[model samples]
Target: MIVVLIGYMASGKSTLGRILAKKLNYDFLDLDDYIEEKEQLLVSDIFKSKGEIYFRKVETLYLKMLLENNTKLVLSLGGGTPCYSDNMNFIRNTVKAKSIYLKASIPTLVSRLKTEKSKRPLIAHLETDELLTEFIGKHLFERSQFYNLSEVTITTDNKTEEAIIEELVLKLF
Candidate 1:
């Protein structure tokens, strides 16, 4: 009963994963947080200190480690997790894991990410809403090839958190 939530940034993977894990009484693991704990560095710090290639490798390694060692868990992946290093392929083929994509429109993402930009390394340099919007649109477009492979795709636009969770529970159960 391992559930993996995937999406672009600010798509509610972490927020929804926490509540879903609680409702199901499963262990909740956010891979970025897990990596921070394991490496003793924030994800952004890892990217800054070691570079994205290194971060991606370590992320892939840690992702596989978590999937192999855990069960009855709800996992929230980093926004870029699926887009990197055959990770999507591994997630899709893993036994006992159900992958769900939290789909959000570029506008929805732009709105959410605008205020949270400083906390996100990838878009931290983006200074304008226009720039952020463009980046999200392009990024999501490229990532959709991978994200669309999810076992379930839930559109999060205009949906309440509880409503989204209810839909997820219905689809999952």
Candidate 2:
């Protein structure tokens, strides 16, 4: 089985994916990191040099490639991966692939992202917690529709990583 983790930035997709992979003895592949390794460039660099349209195209391509080739794997996707293209539909329809949405409250997302904004290109330019909160609220509202389409929806708000993982394990099995 393939486990795909989808959520907004700082929603713990990568971290949970790593832990879940270790627990399940599955290969862990972060889609952004995979793209970076394959393209020999940072996602930020891809956005800066080639623009979002190009980046989205490559992202979709790699997503399809990985879904086609991998099994017994844990895949953590970029926050916007599902919102663009028909990626969410593809993920949902793909056999043996399970997509789990890590649903976080806007406040939870804002609190986590405020400190780590520099590491995330999309939210890096957002200054001040208020601005970040506002942006997350609106962005999350827009993205939630796509996110809610996942096979499983796990709320991460106020939950420890271990707790979240535990719940996910119960759900998956």
Candidate 3:
């Protein structure tokens, strides 16, 4: 079975994926990191040099390849993975993949993202707190429908990584 964790940036997908994979004794694949390795470039670089359209094409290719090589694995997908192209539908239909959405409040997301802005590509240029909050709110609202399609939705507000993982494990099995 494949476990795909999807959420907005700073929603703890990678961290929770790692913990969940460990708990299940399955391998873990971070979709962004996998893309970076395959493309031999940082995701930020891809966005800067070729633009989002090109990068998402590459993302789709890599996503398909990963699914082909499937074993029992936990995958942490990018924030926009499900929102773009046919990626969400592909995941839903491909394997015994169970989708999990990590839901975080706007304020919680803003606080978490502020410190790690340098790492994420899409929201890196968002400077002011007000602007960042508003931007995230708009994006989150727009993407909520795709996110709500997940088989399990877990709220991550004010929860430690371990607690979230525990909740996810229970919900998943």
Candidate 4:
């Protein structure tokens, strides 16, 4: 079985996914990391050089390849992964992957991301809180439909990673 974690930036998808995979004895793959490995480039570099269109195409390709491998894995996707091209349907239909969206309010997201701004490619350059809020708002709006398509949705506002994963494991397994 494959579990796919989806959500907005700083929503704890990767951290919770790693913990869930460890407890469940499943392989863990962060989609961005996989793409970086496959392309021999950082995600930031990919965005700078190839543009989001190209990066997304590569993302789709990697996702299909991962599904074909058919291993028990937990995949943590980029914030925008599900919003593009048949990606959401591909995960749901082809792999029959359990999709989970870790939802968070804009305030929570902005607060969490403030500390890690240097690590995120998309939001790193936005210096002001207002700019960050606007960016997240646009992205959340664009991707909400796909995010909402998940079989399970967990709100992460003020919740600990351990608690979120515990709840997720119960619902998914």
Candidate 5:
């Protein structure tokens, strides 16, 4: 099975996915990291040098390649991956693929993304917590529709990674 983890920035898709993959003994692949490795450019650099449209197109290509070619895999996608290129539908329709939305409240997301903004390309330019919170609020609202299409939704606010993983495993099996 291909387990695809989707959510907004700092919602723990990649972090939880690594542990989930370890526990399930599945091959773990982070789409952004995969893109960096394959394209030889940092995700942020891709955005700056080529633009978001180019990045999204490449992201969709690699998403299709990974889902089509792998099984027993845990795939963690970028925050905007589902919102672009009909990627969520592709993930949902893929054979043996299960999409899990790691849902986090806006406050929880803002708190997490505050510390993580430097690493994330999208919110890095927001200079204040208020701006960050506003961005997250609006971005989450826009992307929630795509994210809600997931086969499973796991709320992650104030939850330990182990607890989230436990819930994920139960729901997945």
Candidate 6:
């Protein structure tokens, strides 16, 4: 089975995916990291040098490649991965692939993303928590439609990683 973890930034997709993959004894692959390794450039660099259109095209290409080629895998996707191209549709239709949305409340996301702004290119420009909160609110609102298409939706607000993983395991099995 291919377990695909989807959610907004700082919503614990990568962190939980690593742990979930271990528990399930599945191989783990983070799509952004995979892209970086394959392209020999950072995602941020890709966005800066080639622009978003080019990045999205390659992103879709790799997503298809990974989904088609892997099994017994836990794939962690970028926050925006599903929103662009027919990526979500492809995941939904893929056999043996289960898409899970790690939903986190706006406040939860704001708090988590506060300290990690520098690491995230998308939210790095906001100068204040209020701005960050507002940005996340609007961005998540826009993205939630795509996210809600997941086979399973796990709300991670105020939940420990262990608890979230426990719930995920139960739901997936």
Report each candidate's C-alpha RMSD, comma-separated, in the order given: 0.8, 0.8, 1.2, 1.2, 0.9, 0.6
Show the lowest summed lDDT stretch of 10 residues, model 5.
Answer: 115-124
**What does candidate 1's lDDT look like per residue over 24-142, in tens digits?**
99999999999999999998889889999998999999989888888989999998899999999999989889999999999999999999898887898999999999999999999
Clashes per model (N, Cα, C within 3 A) = 0, 0, 0, 0, 0, 0
lDDT of 2 by residue, 1-173 (tens): 99999999889999999999999999999999999999999999999999999999999999999999989999999999999999999999899899999998988888888888888878889989999999999999999999999999999998888899999999999
Candidate 4: tens digits of C-alpha lDDT, residues 2-74: 9989999788888988999999999999999999998999999998999989999999999888876866899
By lDDT, the best candidate is: 6
Better of 3 and 5 by lDDT: 5
The TM-score obtained by model 3 is 0.95
Instruction: Please give, for residues 77-99, the per-residue lDDT of candidate 6 as tens digits.
Output: 99999999989999999988999
Candidate 1 Cα deviation (angstroms), residue 124 = 1.8
Please write out the lDDT profile of model 3 over residues 1-173, one tens digit for every residue: 88999999988899889989999999999999999998899988888889999999999888877777787999999988898888888888876788999999999999999988877767779988898899999999999899988889999998888889889889888
* TM-score between candidate 4 and the true structure: 0.94
Kindly report which residue stretches of model 5 are placed more than 4 angstroms away from their true locations once superposed: none
lDDT of 5 at 159: 91
Pull out the clashing pairs in model 3. none
Candidate 3 CA-lDDT value? 0.90
Among these predictions, the greatest TM-score belongs to 6
Instruction: Please list the C-alpha lDDT of all candidates, in the order they appear.
Output: 0.94, 0.94, 0.90, 0.89, 0.94, 0.95
Candidate 5 lDDT, 22-98, residue by residue in tens: 99999999999999999999988998999989999999999999999999999999989999999999999997999
